[model samples]
Target: MASESPACNICESIISQTIQTDDRKEIQIARHTVNEHFDRLQRELLKELQIIENDKRKEISKILAPVERKEKEIDGLQISLAIIKQHASDLQTFLVSKQIEHELIDTDNLIQSIQNNSELSGVIVSLQTIGMMKSLGNISRFGQTSQSDMSLVRQKIKQAQAKVAVVTKGSLDHQHGTIKTEEGL
Candidate 1:
């Protein structure tokens, strides 16, 4: 079929040129015609896509409104829940602080009782004197051991606190860090 198509004649000619295609202008015209058709097809496809995209945008807007409203509702609920949680944490801290206050009152009473007792004070002094004498005897030999023991304890505390720091700070931001345990220990 392609071979059967007739060639067009152009104006200029080479010595050996045929009547069908004699010059560069004719070749350029043919190429331009094919390219124009291809360009037109591409433009039609793009226009079709644009129409489809506009329809999709309208459809999507209709569908998305309810989803957007539901998302806002969910966000509102989350914010409310966060506020409630914050209040609960605040109340918990208040309760703990109140409990600590009660325990501190008990501790103060006990400490006051001890301080007011003359007999207890004498016993404390004698115990301290005996402890001092014993420690003085071991001080030269056990000084390094005692220092190392203190260092080890501090190191353990530092490591533990490092691990606890994040949790502690976050909790404190949400609540409080006042002492709440019983005072005896």
Candidate 2:
């Protein structure tokens, strides 16, 4: 019995070491899985954000095209008016002046229409990440590790049965004492 004590302690130490080694491997695998998932998620998010930025930029460019054309038209009209004033007769100047006035009014109306439509005013691009942010904030850990008591119980029962068998054999061979089972019978 005294010699069995060291053997039991050695068995327990081996079991503990094996469990710790298995736990370390499982933990490393979990860490790698978590990192891979996050890396994939980050790539997907950045791709989505880049696509949104490009789309918004295209929309803004579309909105600015007509305004830019109108600005050039206005500049051309002003240059033409200055040229006509310096180089044309009164009658020609008057006729061109009337045409220039109508063009200016049309340009003003177009600008007003653009303003009323709110095309430029309402061009807003924003990321809606409140839910994602909240979810991230709520995450306490990547994963959980748990030990089941059923396996431990089964192992202890097997160990106890083996000890009982050894004691039974010793008693039968040496006839030293009676074997005491768990029931104390």
| Most lDDT-accurate candidate | 2
lDDT of 1 by residue, 1-185 (tens): 12211221111122225433444556677678869987997798778777776876776566556556655655665555566657778776565556555555655565566458632332211113587578667855311211124445445545655667778878886553333333333
Query: Worst 10-residue stretch by lDDT in candidate 1?
Result: 4-13
Query: Candidate 1 local accuracy as lDDT?
Result: 0.54
TM-score of each: 0.34, 0.64
Q: What is the lDDT of residue 117 in candidate 2?
A: 88
Highest TM-score scorer:
2
**Over 4 Å off in model 2, which ranges?**
3-10, 141-185
Error of 1 at 46 (Å): 1.2
Pairs clashing in candidate 1?
none
Native RMSD of candidate 1 (Å):
53.9
